[model samples]
Target: MISACGRDNVGSKNTAQASHSSADAATRTIQTVKGKVQIPAHPKRILTDYYAGELLSVGGHVIGAAPLEFTNPFLKDKLKGAVDVGDPINVEKALALKPDLIVTDSDKNYDQLCKIAPTLYIPYGTAHNIDETVHLFSRIVGQTKPGERLLAEYREKAAAGRKALKGVVAPGATAGLYEITDKGDLWVFGPNWGRGGQAIYNALKFKLPPKLAASNKQYLQLSLEALPQYAADYMFLTSYDPEHKGTALKNLRQSPVWKDLPAVKEHRVFYNDFNTFYPYDPISITKQIDLFVDMLKQNAKENKPGQGQGR
Candidate 1:
């Protein structure tokens, strides 16, 4: 009887070891500073901290998304069915969902998030750089594709958009972008400041002010009274609020120097949908390029009748 009891205990121990080994083999685990994160063979519930809209467009269904003070029309219209988990700092709400995987903007909250579920920290890049943002999201959502086919296809689309834009942006035309603030201070864009400006410049190939090439990599700052310095052949203005329309346009028009600038003189200041003006991925950029090209075409048409005709 004593021998039989010892054999049973050994057999039970062997069975436990074998079960653990099989489980380890079946799961895919990634090591990070937070520890090991195991990826389930099939993940069903997904929660995203940012870029929830991008994930949905790429065929992933998210159960929860970070809350916003105001809904993004682009996201609100499409994700009517998704639940808002309040915000990035809303731990209680996020915990209630019991997600299978959590996707965040970076390694922030790594320790806490890893404890909740296997988390993938995607780098969205800084305001000046979006290469990391585009690439990371592409991989997570499977935009890279089999044999890099999807990437090739997306590249083709971007190339085509650039080609189409070449015919429209007039020779010698210069442009500037502005971000309006509540204090009425205009944060002029530069090559290294915002993703919107960088992507726009990449697509339109517009002539940039010499100041953009300086060490600052940012354009000159000015009071509303000094708006003339920013006026050029073409100007794109962006604001977070609809109310800024009257104020932004009025400020530029009333300034004596601003009113005399070539772009302002020609009424070339175009307001953009504050949200669509920026992009997170190539597809978003392509859409904005199409809008810019159309604007340039219209400007050319309106100016054609007076060209070389004299006033």
Candidate 2:
């Protein structure tokens, strides 16, 4: 793992070494749609659970993130004195902090978290949506208007970014989101109903394979033997770590059928940020789009004019 306190960790976790942070008695009170939540006006000893990304976007540093709760390289480096608070549902460690305020989505065990601190539930999309999440979280932090503005800027950027990639992407290129497991299980993402695949398709308006229309909200199983049938113009290889430097990728490459797919043969497979692709949020979605554009642009450089695709 990358050093958690290095300059590269964009999301800083140095709660103990915070330039400015206060204890519960010195915190400020924030009023929100849910209710008033008293926070250490400028808490130095903050604890985060499920919504670390949400908090990071709103300038909130985490003293804790769940063990499995992944953070990017930027966040990993800055989290000094940070503790792995366990998963969002783990009430035991969460209660020990006696945190002034806890931020999370509604899907978590709110009742238990509430007992530990003045918990704030913003729902799943709030952390995912560009504006809604920032606005809601900023309000919880007692700085609503700024959060609103930031979200607006993000939307503007997202729109501009999408428009920039429109013409560059080829038309009618069917795409699929592949969920690969350590156990060799394969799950294909369906149409744009919900989930990361939907979020990705929604932002860029990418086309889906016809067979995926009825495959919403569920994983479509594919054995190694049947990998070729589901191959599309482009396969968004997700849920794997590229940093492992050929760890999972090496395993996938060794699959006999996986190595023989048309997309693989054509070198049309691209790795995606696994963290966001599994269960997505707007920030993750936008980030993924940006990545897609980067990869697409790279692909364009090598392909003949008529070889590109989109849908």
What C-alpha lDDT do the candidate models reach, one value each?
Answer: 0.55, 0.58
* lDDT of each residue in 161-182, candidate 1, tens digit only: 6677565666555777776654
Q: lDDT (0-100) at residue 54 of candidate 2?
A: 57
Q: In terms of TM-score, which candidate is strongest?
A: 1
Question: Model 2 residue 258 lDDT?
Answer: 78
Clashes within 3 Å, all models in order: 0, 22
Residue-level error in angstroms, candidate 2, position 209: 3.1
Give lDDT for model 2.
0.58
Off by over 4 Å in 2: 1-46, 77-81, 88-96, 105-112, 120-132, 135-139, 190-199, 225-229, 239-251, 273-283, 304-311
Give the alpha carbon lDDT tens digit for every residue of 1-311 in model 2: 01111122233221111112244555454433344345555544456665665566666666677664555533455565667877654678776765666766543676667666665555443322455556656645554554555466556656765677667667767777787765556778663322356445655667776567545443577776776766787788765544455555567778788778877666677766565455443345455556666777777666554574321
Question: Candidate 2, TM-score vs. the true structure?
Answer: 0.66
